[model samples]
Target: MAPGARRLATEVVLPVPESGDPVVVELGAGAGVFTGLIQELLGGRGHHLAVEADPRLASSLAARHPRARILNDDASALPQLLAEYGLGAADVVISGLPWAGPDRATQRTTLDCVRRVLAPQGAFTAFGYAHATRLTSARRFRRMLGSSFEEVIPGRTVWGSMPPAFVYHARRPRPRKSAETIDLLAAQLASRAAAATDMRF
Candidate 1:
């Protein structure tokens, strides 16, 4: 496992509450490192979902974290998955996605997904390397997150892990749009694009 991945797993385990039926979701769970830690944190008591894009990792997570429902899909599909499980919202969402910087598209999609599945005042936590935050990519990520989430706060650094790491903690706000709203917006955009193309012809 990579040093950054280890640090992120540790970060996820630190802030979880000891009791309560907290619904947890983990994105980019590569190699089951963070997935296993999340399972341990939950103690097989609550609903846990692990989303991994890699089939092999998803399979490994399914075998290792039997308590967790492994979803072999993209992070963007989170909202739909939560609905399928009848989960109105998640108490926490942990992410360890590898990106060069804050991806606006991903930020928007993920924030939308989080809002749909996160309960009011629920937290969304993700980590990136400390060195990456110093770069321009990190700045963009922060800006994107600021626009999407109600409160974006930086968490403590994981010093024991390699290269060091910092976690971003954001709380979901109330009165947010549903996943259906986002789907409608996407359809509207597609319709507009198709209309423009027809006009050109």
Candidate 2:
């Protein structure tokens, strides 16, 4: 769970598109903490589709934010959900899930799903605990994140939250790299990840 600390809903502001009538997607929207914030930022402009895996949570979220078009489905079904909803690629995708908790294959699969539905210049964000970034799965997750996008920038840690967490803002999603490029990417990712090691959440 990213930024679980409730600042009475004032802790962090979910990033929204600057343009009018933008399409925003929310993944793992537990209890609609950021969902409500996103709606307020939208201010009746554009569409907000929230994907919550739990049917019970989705049902309640649907009622709480009727404007969001809540879907009780997995995040991996994002592209299909967008097509069925008749919406094009998303302008922004926000995640409230604890991404590092999953295995490598699962994380890669989910990232692929997100890449498939993001607009060319669209941005994707997910928050995680900085302290855990050094763990094996977390490192793998970070490496995959770096490879999936041309730019993967970690956001400021919300120290106000219990155990603290930070968001990752990635843009310019990239396709799978060739073997030669993969070799070079490994070097780049190492340097990038190393630079963030001293950061505190």
**Candidate whose TM-score is highest:** 2
- State every prediction's TM-score relative to the real structure: 0.78, 0.83
Query: Using lDDT as the measure, which candidate wins?
Result: 2
Please report the TM-score between candidate 1 and the true structure.
0.78
lDDT of 2 by residue, 11-70 (tens): 334458656998999899889988998888888899999999999999999988988889
For each candidate in turn, give its C-alpha RMSD to the true structure in angstroms: 7.9, 5.6
RMSD of 1: 7.9
Indicate the worst ten consecutive residues by lDDT in candidate 1. 174-183
Q: What are the per-residue Cα lDDT tens digits for candidate 1 across 64-180?
A: 777889999998899889989998888888887864454656666665676667778788887777778766456656655555566888878877667778788877643455434
Angstrom error at residue 55, model 2: 0.8
**lDDT of candidate 2 vs native?**
0.80
After superposition, the stretches of candidate 1 with alpha carbons farther than 4 Å from their true spots are: 1-8, 99-102, 174-201
Return the lDDT, model 2, position 42: 88
TM-score of model number 2:
0.83
